[model samples]
Target: MEIKFGDAKYYAYTGTHDPASDLESVVFVHGAAMDHTVWAHQSRYFAYHGYNVFAVDLPAHQFSRGELLLSIERMAAWLNQVIDQTVGTAFHIVGHSMGALIALEAAANFNHPDAGLNSLSLIGFSYPMSVTPQLMDAAQHNPSEAYSMMTQWSHASAIGGEPVPGFWSAGMQLSMMENSTAGSVHTDLIACDNYAGGEAAFVKVTCPILFLSGMRDKMAPAKLAQAEADKNNNAAIVLLPDCGHSIMSESPDGVLNELKRFIGARK
Candidate 1:
């Protein structure tokens, strides 16, 4: 599923369309180092509900061809082009982790005229990028410790109550540290932690925003997400009772159910 665009190549997978009704389109964006496979659960669930689904591999990771620019701006630009090509005007954008930043860029930074998106649903994200210095320092100096913390924190006993299965641990580990030139993985962590635009660009976003968070999301922190969601005139914040950073994996059914209702309410 390679599509040549300018000098870059993007990998895309289309899930089965929803049978309930005709949907405009749905694009699922994955975070850093992760591929479209990350959305396997979400895509299948949503597509079955009667909507077109598109899961894409982000730049520098997986099936995509290009040196990792690692810039959210470039990420949005690439997504805009893809949308215009396939659906002419494209559709709603759903993003997680690093992909959330790209969605923000699409709604705020880039503002593609052909995006044709009516809404945005951002899960596991917080505005103003509160990726504190403590987290950043830990990620760079002690990646293993950081990884362990992620695993431990992902449990229901941690921040939120939802428990992440050990099944995803291997995938997450490999994605973060698989291929690299010595310190590239650490470098990626730094870039992600120090991502820009904070809250200014986000506040200007006019589209309806749906913010998802775990009651105790170690990364985004529930309180922070709620406050960010409050700034938007058309935003709704949902705290998955006992979820962690990876809300999709921690509570796939919860997310899908909420999305089903969200989609129903929109039209």
Candidate 2:
């Protein structure tokens, strides 16, 4: 689906389902340098099973056409505008990696007694999410190296084999990053590295929150996610064993099941 905000046009994958007023909404936001396709498995399932799914491509990341928002706060604010224009009634947000940070900020700002933010699911998240200098440098001057490093680190193993037939997890991720808009990876890394409001944002969110961590994650460690979840009274953590930063691809079924149980219970 296409949504216009001013002169810019944004693309959201609706799983081939049209939006309706009666159905609840679930928005999926992907990590840095990634697009709506990262949520392919989870979003399509939710859309097919009676929910309005919006797997969004952040501005300048993929099909979305606009200048890239350079910080987490700006991205969060843009997300709020998207929700206001597209979603009606109760809604839930599912986000991963960098997107998780955006979701946190957005929920803190947008969720209210009558705002209809039913729940929040943060996957591959950590507070004070720092990016290494080496990775940042690579993203700026040697993007292919950055993509290779991220792809290798994102999964438990490069050759461990994916559950889906005829698929290579690491290769697919690398391709996605390679295909992203030029300099977007560095832009996203800077946003994650410089953001200092995560702890404050976590406390502001009042709705139930899910911290979905990958046990073997190298980027945002599970321990960090646990610490943040520990701070929030309404937050819970679920660890995906043998998975890494890319939980959606490495443990698709586990991610989907947890989201179903968490959001379904609230409904």
Off by over 4 Å in 2: 111-115
Candidate 2 TM-score to native: 0.97
| lDDT tens digits by residue: candidate 2, 15-54 | 8888877888999999999999999899989999989989
The numbered model that scores best in TM-score is 2
True-structure Cα RMSD, model 2? 1.3
Q: Per-candidate RMSD vs. true structure?
A: 4.0, 1.3
TM-scores of the candidates are 0.80, 0.97
lDDT tens digits, residue span 29-85, model 1:
876545677677788876666567778876666677766655667677778767655
- Clash count, predicted structure 1: 9
